[model samples]
Target: MRDWWRDLTDLVLPAECGGCGRPRTVLCARCRAALGGTGPCRVRPAPEPAGLPPVHAAARYADEVRATLLAHKERGALALSGPLGEALSGAVRAGLATVRAPGAGGGSVLLVPVPSARRAVRARGHDPVRRIAYAAAGELRRAGVPAHVLPALRQRRDVADQSELDARQRLANLAGALTVAPGCGRLLSAGRVVLVDDLMTTGASLAEAARAVRARSWADSPVRGAGSSISGPASVYGGETRERRGEQRNGPAQQWAGRRSGRPPVTAGADSADGVVDGMCAAVVAASPDAFEISRN
Candidate 1:
């Protein structure tokens, strides 16, 4: 009832810009530009986590972007989902472009949103990430990309609030905290999976989410042993290994690694033959400003 009433009120009320409280508009044009003006780019936390997927973000979480995100997340500015989703869609496209390769299946895209804790959801009366994901799927579809929202991840255990936690502590708190919901693995296999989040800070949550997805996916598959064939985006070609391809030119693996470390951007390709590779990319609307720094390493 709270969410329903909020929706009704939003329709009847004189709106203010979520970003800067401008009168008579839900979002001013200037603030809207701030959300995704510069376009999406690769971002990485300073100390990237092991197994963290390559991530793309639409904007730095600062100034108007920060205020706008908080308004939608904490203050029930539900209408902001549209613009937020638009930003996320840009990031999604950017991430997809980097990982897709030749022979990659152009099937439907699955956006698996990082789940909030049950308590948080109850307090907020809406799932912010999931809400934004649906809007993002709409944006993708309008752009001629088939997309779907797949709420496949869930919190399997309680975690401490991340606001006060340092990077190491945040990681430790989220370790083993997430799991794939039962009966979702088969659906996950149906399309390319891209993890979506509203914001990524230390990247602890995304790392844990990736770990859970990989664990469940590998466990459910019948093919696991050494003889089992495994393929990755840009890692396989006609009768050639990634090493051979790398020797010939900078291949997909190099692009994937380089993107995660904020190295110079390189073109890569997306693949769908393998769930492992299909799930190794993520997108977000915003991230810390420092995350956009180019790493010299």
Candidate 2:
């Protein structure tokens, strides 16, 4: 009922720019340019996390971009999903270009979003990341790329709020909080999986998610009902699994180790059969973080 009323109200409300509150438009032209310009760029938190995948951000988390994202995410400015998805699609494309090798087989690309806690979803009345991922997939398909969203990742343990933590603290707090959904290993193994998130700060959340996904082992031979094969070291703090396997194999473990040591992580695209490209892709509509900040003056 609340959702229905909100939708009806939005339909009747006077137009206003979501970024700067300009009248007569949902997203004004100037703001739209600010949000979408410059193409996608690589972004790394000041202090990167361990084992984090290479990450690409469409825009810096500041200015008009920040405003637009917050408006859509926190205030339920649902109409902005189109532009946001478009922005994210660019990031996905950029991220894919970074990791894919020349002539690699392009299989289907699976976008696995980092799940929000139930409490957060209940408070917001929606799951923002999942919604954005769906929108992003649509954008990808329109560009002749086959993509799908898999909501098969979830928090396996409770975690404290992350708003106040530094990179290291954030890592410790989120270390074992994620797990693949039941029966999701096969889905992950079926194609390349790219972890997607709306915003990344410390990157602890994404790193932990990658770790959890990597840790779950896939049975060498397919099993009828073995329930996903679960092997590998479990974290002492949380009993979450940590290793994974499939018909497709990972690059030498050393390759990941060196990559992890060098810089913040970003998605790497994989090549598909018939010369289709697959790998991790990320996209965002805006890059400015300051746009969302409230001015005191």
Query: Best-fitting candidate, measured by lDDT?
Result: 1
- Residue-level lDDT for 74 in candidate 1: 97
CA displacement after TM-score superposition, residue 224 of candidate 1 (Å): 2.3
Return the lDDT, model 2, position 158: 82
lDDT of each: 0.74, 0.61
Output the number of the TM-score-best candidate.
Answer: 1
lDDT of 2 by residue, 64-129 (tens): 778888888889876677777777777777766654432346566677888888898888777778
Lowest-sum lDDT 10-residue window in model 1: 232-241
For model 1, what is the error of residue 238's alpha carbon versus the real structure, in angstroms, after optimal superposition?
A: 30
Clash pairs, candidate 1, are: 99-269, 99-270, 100-269, 100-270, 101-269, 101-270
Q: Put down candidate 1 lDDT per residue, 108-212, tens digits, no spaces.
A: 788999999899999999999999999999999999989899999989888889999976677668776888899986676666668899999987787667666
Whole-structure CA lDDT of model 1: 0.74
For candidate 2, give the lDDT. 0.61
Lowest lDDT sum, 10 consecutive residues, model 2, at 236-245
Q: For candidate 1, give the lDDT of residue 241.
A: 13
